[model samples]
Target: MCDQYRKSYRLGRRPGEQGPRPLSRNQDRVEKLATGTATTTTTKTKPTTDSSTANATTTNSSTANPSITILTTNPTTANSRKTNSTTVNPATVKAKDSSTTTKTITDPGRAKTRKPNQTTTNLTTANSATANSATTNSTTTNSVIVKTRDSVTTNTTGTSTRPARITNKSTITITKVPKCKTQKLKITKNTLTVGTWNVRTLWAAGKLDLLRHEMNRYRYDIIGISEVRWTGKREIPRGDFIWSGENSNHIRGVGILLSTKAKKSLMSYNPINSRIIMARFNATPFNVTIIHAYAPTSDSSEDDIETFYNCVEEAIEKVPKKDVIIITGDWNAKVGTDNTGWESVMGRYGYGSRNERGERLLEFAAEHNLFICNTRFQQTSNRKWTWESPDGIHKNMIDLVIVQKRWKTSVTNCRTFQGADISSDHSLVLCNIKLKLKNKPRHNQRYDVSQLKDQTTRQSYQARIEDNLKNIHSTCNLNEHAAQIEKAVKEALQATVTLEKTSKKSWIFDQTLDLTDKKRKAKQIKHLSADSIKEYKNLCNKVKNRHDRTKKSGYKINVKKLKKDYKLATAEKRTVW
Candidate 1:
């Protein structure tokens, strides 16, 4: 069903060199769908004396997509209101005089918005509710006090689940805070597997006739297919072209494909040449975009893939480069090799260099603050052509996706759908990204006012805080201890990383024995709090013991060590001395 929307926002500076005023109010107001008529409206609001008075009201017929709006204003005079109440009730009160009655979570994630005299609400629930507003240098602050409780979930049937809302004071400020971090995104389900695959070309596989079945086999939330070939200027081959990418077959008709689930959240769309596609996605995760592209193959004449390279570069620039972009699809370029082309591109982001299109991809990702999901476990050789010949000679690994860097630490259970390749030339790679959202304790939050209230509580809180600081200080001190222990353990482990036992090939017993005199001066950092140097000395002793054991007479040399020494012998600087 279609819905309507109304929104207002203003930005200006406050007087007296103070901050600006930003007020936001949401009224999901609906005068029953009377037989006569019913319509929605956006109410205006201004800076309230109390931050708690400001609120957002949302209404809907059922638990589906609802129309929503937001309002923001520059600052007016911020009339500070100071009231002394020794005994404060944890109960929250709405700001302003308006009684915008709507369901709000009992948890105080409710915030006094920054938009002045502005209210928004919608009845469309098919999409995620992204209604939000904020202001910097606002005089308002929220202080949460924790009380012990158990069994937080309600077991009632046909009930709505709401997020635990924290209360933050709205102020007359102008600092840009990333809304994704401030607003809580609802999780639609337990997991959404977002994958990227390079399907060589749609028409190549004898088995690829089963493309539809292959696609439907897995429960995928979002998927990006690269190398969708078509004749130039031709009508789009796929009706589901929510966003189209590059055009290549004779070298420039490849494009991208998205699942119905992902297309449901499209907001803004932009095509990056014939090789790159960019689209802003909406909902639970805030504003995220998908960049579908296929980097050039190393085999191509460098100039041949320049257009695709430009397309990718422009896509990175056209889209909000700072936002989380899932760049997936066929990247024919390999990293981990010394070809140097991959190194050239990765240099733009900061520091990464490799030759395997995979390794270079990893480096490019690192430079651009992105992370690749392919672990060494799931990682495989780039050999074995995805697009095979009748004789099955040529093969190379070239499809992948890289995630935003921040997400790398949280993503889990990453794997590839090699089985899906039964129908296509390339395997379908899939990974279930699990976000381990840190639920920090309320009392431990840095901005908690309870820690700064007065001398008494401040003293108590500072005491606890200092203990934490000291624990950190202690942990840092232990780093040296840990490192020293690590060096010693490494000397032991070094025995295992390669072979250590000497060889007993009697035919070559005359192999010259000379002192390596391996000179490595320890740049000892002196610190009283740090651990003693005894541990490092112990490590030196262990290495000495190993050297002694290996050089002893009549010692039967281990076979593995012989192989290792042979490899080391090939190393000009490294030798058996």
Candidate 2:
């Protein structure tokens, strides 16, 4: 009995205590304890300590008045022996009717309290009524404790007539969002076909027609013509032929034939000399500058060759550096198969042996950083050679389509078309280039002005103009007034006159076309005997004679028509006078 009494006293229990004793006395002195310890104790008439804690002290209170005590500890201090205690007086705490109090505590930590890094959270809520309802005292005591070194946070919620005070540091964090990105548009590409043909002579009768026929057949956007013996520089709108030659007499000349499409995009053209003619077109990505050149023969003097190349260089210098420069013509220089020293300027697929003129061409190409597109593609001997000897024994690849080395990829393919016959010993050298050309707007609207000659039509036009002008009041601005007048005139013309319907008339007879076709076929024959050559020459002469006759007859017919029109105009003038 005496030993039992001593044990109870050491365990913080009185000798006369009747209730069950605590399990251990030193449990309160532990290094770390469980978090969120909650205790509920009922006393009949005296104060009592909870069974969960041995060191918890309580004050005396009436049976009608009950109190709650909460205790918490910091776990950051591994060797900490201190305890934080909080006590609430029954007289101070007040709760409303039908109110709810909720408490939550979170502690995520290892079993060992010696860990340096541990987080703890504590929440406490209490609700109680006024002192008048002390007799029905129903208290819920909830304690939540979390411990850390310097960081401590607590949340307390309760429904009471009085406000509860709290003292703890807290931290909050905020985040942000990001934005979106935009997209890009796709660009379209187009193909431009550029060709070079050595038409021996445009000065010959019916030669321009043959050239146009071949151009239409091949669908070439631009074809550079060499050895065009046309005297003086002129632009023929019939076939969009822009040629440059000797001012005095028929000699070596260069020209460029443009399709309707090419004509629309043609910005400007320069007739440098009889040997060189340049034309520039507005295209997408870059403008195109085409220089059609007719170089002197290989047997020519060095001074002549130098002078020709100097003129070509001057033309190139005039072109904008950013423009796509395409030099197409009959160079009359053979750059052979070997591309050892001139690998950058010429390719290995070239035909025949290189000559002195070829060496000069290679030097010029290298100096200008240009690529000979003809020599860049592999083709058979027949397709590779651009010109043949008179006896058909010797042939050479002289004509070339040269382009800037930087834009070599733009030239997809370059080769000779042997089937295209323009009464020339040389074959047509064509090149396919990828380019996006700008659309040219048509400005020339050909109205039937001949309708104005009719008296009734003239009166109708005058009446329409008067009606339009009546509605268009003159504005203070001169420009506006002029624009109104122009609009009125245009509207009157639109109402009275019609657009001239141009009927395309083929000038050459079918017999002449058939003869030309036969000539082309005979030239294409692989094995041409003496009889075939004689036949080809005879056919050429016949075609030329027929062309001369047709030309003269057409000229006489035009002169007669002009005389009749002049007479009619003079008679009308005399009647009006």
Candidate 3:
């Protein structure tokens, strides 16, 4: 027990950063101990007359509490006999070394503070060797704060394991508080459901509502929508749905819908153009930026393709180097099963044969070091295809989800959901990825400084600051004085300005959404019957025409409002000047 305690105390000090501690005589002992070398020293003392002579003492004293035993021998003058016995609490004895250093070990169970070059070891009720306060050095091993507790075990690697036990005996559990309470919590992200679909046009009546139902059914964190056909740029938030889009001609449009979970981590969404949109999320260790695109069809001009790719490249370049990027949308490309030299970006599970569009996409992905997630996972023929012909005779996998090659393993599954009813020719292509949301520090509350524009408010604020400064004038410490000054300024500003709550307004009507759903169901029925095709087409045209007029009316109202606001602002500016 004494040997074990001494070893634990001595080894507590970490090795020097300049490499091993020059392997001195003392360090040799440490190395031997580390290598399981067993060496012991023993000393015997002899008593003569009435004096007790000292035994050979070690230069390094043991850290454990010591029990000193003194033996005295006295010659009996009359009887000529000798008696030997032990006495406790003997006089404090200091062992002398060649360097004139004195070593002292206190009484058992009473540990003392360790010296600069000293260490301490103690035994708990369970007789385990534990360091009282081990000083850290250059060793990679972490220092652990150990406490005596029943049914508690700690490892040196900074991990603790607690097993479940059913016992009738009452027990008290004491856990050691972590050294740093402000340490960030470890964030672990599991499988996330992401999807993309090209819903011919979001301008159709009730398309957003029908889309919401499908989104809720799949419980997707984020889903990209293409061909939205919505004019202008804006962010629309309804219930748990949030989307951002930009379109000028009401032609091909792209947008992304985020669930409540994703919304909580939503940093910002940028509407790049009618065919492209980007949203960033606060997934940490690396942020995740999802870019939604509606690439031009194969028949589009080469210049159009070049422009589209240029936009895509610009978007990718905008993301930070440390963040993970995912570009998922309808690429209108068909990459066949032959991975060949493109094994890094694709897999053998790809459906159909490679085409000109597919080659372009492959080249883009290779340049960006991205992997197509759809081709990474294997599935059935129906599950692999994302687009089908109107007559349902032809099927192709045009829509795809691509992620950074470095995070390819984060994509657990990528396939099409053949069952989603979004009243579109394209199937919903879903990709599952694992990404953790970082817990960022909350924004500090700020008072409105605009209130300072008023003369009365400005005077009141100045008076408050003066009053606060007077109250904190007694503070002498430099840090304290600065803190008081800051506090005073903040309080004075807060007293002048009250916080206001603002929310965005929605322009689309619920009735219009209902009509869009009716129109969608009619289209679905028309596909099933050759006779009802004409009626279905007529109903679609009617719905489209009505929505077109509604959009035009809404635009006119917005233009008039803008003109009025501009006039009022101009008059106010002239009066102020």
Candidate 4:
């Protein structure tokens, strides 16, 4: 093929023969059909070169490394055509000789290189008119000019002009949902140090000062006092003492002292009578109501006892259900150490055996689901008893502080502060409660060292002590000496000891058991002799009968008196109205 093309070109360059004429359209079609390939052929006229240069048609003999071979028949050098073959990869074809140019085509599958001297245009090679086609002649040097028919489309093989349609299908759905639970929240809370004391009677002079001194020293938030003995219902000046008393009497008074912080939280105060007073304070998570009551003695008439409990119950009923209720005072009831049936309201740590009055108090607590704080914590007998007989022999836990069972865990410790003295036979009963408060000054943490008494703990603690002590040196400065001692102790404790709460020990004593055994033996021995048994039984029956008679007579008298007093007071009220 190369030799035939060279012979034809040489013949056409003869002296007078017309320059090589472009192939007719029919011949071009026939050539493409015979090759069975989609190759685009183009032809243009050029001036004839000299015979020597025309015959010098150089072929890129190495088809394996084909490239554009451009030849120019210069009017001055038309006799020479031998030139070097210029190789060009696809996408870039250059026309070096301006006189005449030739571009060897490889694959006309998609596009053709733009003619160097002509405007760039899109090249379209379609298969059966199904591929994309574009015809645009006015293209800039750096831009592609693509003109397409209305139905032009791009097939996968890029051999057709068929248009394609695209569709999309999607679905989304949503419905309203509600929360499973909505919780109510508390914004602030505080740790409250509440205390209660019988104080016997606050009639002595300067006793308020003693009270104030002790309150300041201990930093109690609220303190309930029994037998305050103030004459009437009034707030004490400078002392923040809210007292409730009889119309004309100095006895059976109950009051509450509020610290500065507590007073600031005070909401209202109610004086039910000389024996009972109730106060409410603002707090968080919930408000708190403190009820102070000085119950009548066990010897008092049943009517009086009933009236006192009635007043207390009425006071408690007035408080909102959401508020924390604390009932504290000297109820003069010995709840005892047996918690068999009263487990919900009393604990086994109580001082002495339960008495009749204690039954009433415990019943009240159970009905209200109140926990007797003092009985819940184990303490030494000395600390458990809040009252002592004048003979200094009888000790009883007659005074108690009670709170709702739901908040029982808040009572960290409840015991009598035997050191507090305000001219009172009754020791101060204090209870510690935890509160979650904002911006509250945290209390100094205290650790109980009693765990060091255990054998294993003692050995470990001793070893730790030895280790820390080895790092210490003799110091003369007082501060340095104190600090070194403290550091050694603290590190030793941290290394070998665990934190434990300081609860009181059991109040049961060996002497108490001995005395009880002696009494039981006396009863059994009394049956040994006929005369002695008769005398003992007779005396016991007489005492029991006498006590029953006295109680019946006292109850009847109280009923009559109460009715008369009620009539008189009602008449007076009617008259005044």
Q: What is the lDDT of residue 88 in candidate 1?
A: 16
State in Å the error of residue 434, model 3.
Answer: 1.3
Best by lDDT: 2
Instruction: Tell me each candidate's TM-score.
Output: 0.36, 0.62, 0.50, 0.43
The better-scoring model by TM-score among 1 and 2 is: 2
lDDT of 4 by residue, 1-577 (tens): 3211221122223333454554443233222222221122323323222232233222252211211122222223323433333222222233323432223333322121211211111222223222332322221222222222232222222122221211111000111111233333343345688888877777654355446655765858889988887788988644378898777878888899888788667777988888888988778778888998888987899999999899999998999999899888889888899999889997778888889998999899999899999988888887899887744568888888999999998877888876665435688888877742222342334556888789998999898888888887775688887888888988888777666543432223334333333433444346467776565455544433443454466568779988888899898785422
Q: Write the per-residue lDDT of candidate 2 for residues 416-513, one digit (tens) a residue.
A: 89989878888988888888778656566778989999999999999999999998766558888889988899889989999986655656778788
- Candidate 2 regions exceeding 4 Å error are 1-189, 442-446, 451-504, 570-577
Candidate order, lDDT descending = 2, 3, 4, 1
**TM-score-based ranking:** 2, 3, 4, 1
Off by over 4 Å in 1: 1-190, 203-209, 232-239, 243-252, 304-307, 336-363, 376-396, 421-423, 434-577
Off by over 4 Å in 4: 1-189, 436-577
Per residue, candidate 3 scores C-alpha lDDT tens digits across 479-512 of 8899999999988987887654335444555665
Better lDDT candidate (3, 4): 3
Task: Report lDDT per candidate.
Answer: 0.41, 0.67, 0.62, 0.60
The number of the candidate with the highest TM-score is: 2
lDDT score, residue 468, model 3?
92
RMSD of 1: 30.6
